[model samples]
Target: METMHKGSAGLVSAPSLREQARKVIRGLVITGQMQPDQLYSVPRLAAELGVSATPVREALLDLEREGLLEAERNRGFRVVSLSLNELNDIFAVRLLLEVPSVGDIAQGGLSDRQLDELHQLAEATRQTADTGNLIAFLDTDLKFHVQLIATLGNQYLAKLVETLRDRVRLQGFASGESPRDFLKQSANEHFKLLDYIAKQDRSGAEATIRRHLERSRGVWGSRHNTTQAAKASVLDESS
Candidate 1:
């Protein structure tokens, strides 16, 4: 929950103001404060952050480069919305990275300390879910999965997975679904995945990961369908 402040006089060595602005804006996008498909004025955002327009504009351009936002002609930027197809594509990449990599890790084996750490994370994720802390649950859940992949000792692969996860997070925020049921189910699956890895059951681990991904995809798909249906109903009423 740390953010780069725009007007912190006590701070030293502010090398790149744009990078700090980018981090602040990226945080807004990730935390669901900035809704998708909505335009945000650069001047307004800068004023809110207590900085000049230049850094905010540059930061927004960086987010656009990262596929999180899109610039309008002579206007401000809009947070990009992910379609169902794009969500599926992201899951496809996750499966490509996680299933094989985590399966390998499971088969190769984990040290007792690593297993214990994963167990603790899994429990923390479940507790967060029970309390209906969606943000905390999501954060801890990502940490669990990312740590799982890190066991392979490949920084690039782990980074790829993390990027894919950030995209997935966008979809989750846009879904507008209730946190209680979906998060509880997700936490349960995390435990099952940990069990598979601890037992060195590579096949089980692979299967569990597939199910987990499919469950997440299904939840997001349901949200998208509901939104579309509501829009269609409104259109029909208007017509």
Candidate 2:
């Protein structure tokens, strides 16, 4: 819930201003820096990002298309809060797309060099999780999974998976466990998955992915009451 102001090193750097705005704003949304009830004016956001209004407007529109923001007439944009049912629907679709795709990748297997690179990413992801750096964890985790899927030789599938991942809102739920423990466990699963893939154990890879997704859904996508509590906590911090 930390505010990322202009010139912050945490802001994503991109080739184009529009893309930079989009990525930074998207990260804010994903990390709950942006709230659902507030209407954010373009000029204010543009100033905060140190970017032009035009690119911020375009970025907001793009996020609208991605179902992350809703525009109001004569106003600005509000974050779109996904309901529990919608979260379930997304996880179901992800299961269908990712399980088989990862299984296929495992059956084919990856080269030693590719595995080494992915291992480095996985280690970074785990380190971030261990340190409780949620933003860094998410970034490394996305790269690890997306790069793994890219090895499957299906750009369209990889892109779809990436889109689905960006849409997910990790509301910092830990179910019955401690947050640190849950995060560490989830990060370790990446290593387990890689082991399965290296051994060409198709069933093991598929099962690991399925378990991982279900665990994520259960912890990250908690009940409605918990979601509201998380939102309230974020609002309190901002206030």
Compared with the true structure, all predictions reach lDDT values of 0.77, 0.80
Using all chains and alpha carbons, the TM-scores for the candidates as numbered come to 0.77, 0.83
* Tens digits of per-residue lDDT for model 2, 1-239: 23443433233345688877887787667666677756798877887887668888999999999778899976899888777777888899999999999999899999999899999999998998889766677778889989999998889988889888877663322223236776788889999999999999999999999999998887657544576787789999999
Name the candidate that leads on TM-score.
2
lDDT of 1: 0.77
The residue ranges of model 2 lying beyond 4 angstroms of the native Cα positions read 1-15, 170-178, 228-239
> Global CA lDDT of candidate 2, please?
0.80
User: How many clashes show up per model?
Assistant: 0, 0
* lDDT: worst 10-residue window of model 2: 169-178
How does model 1 score by TM-score? 0.77
Which pairs of residues collide in model 2?
Answer: none
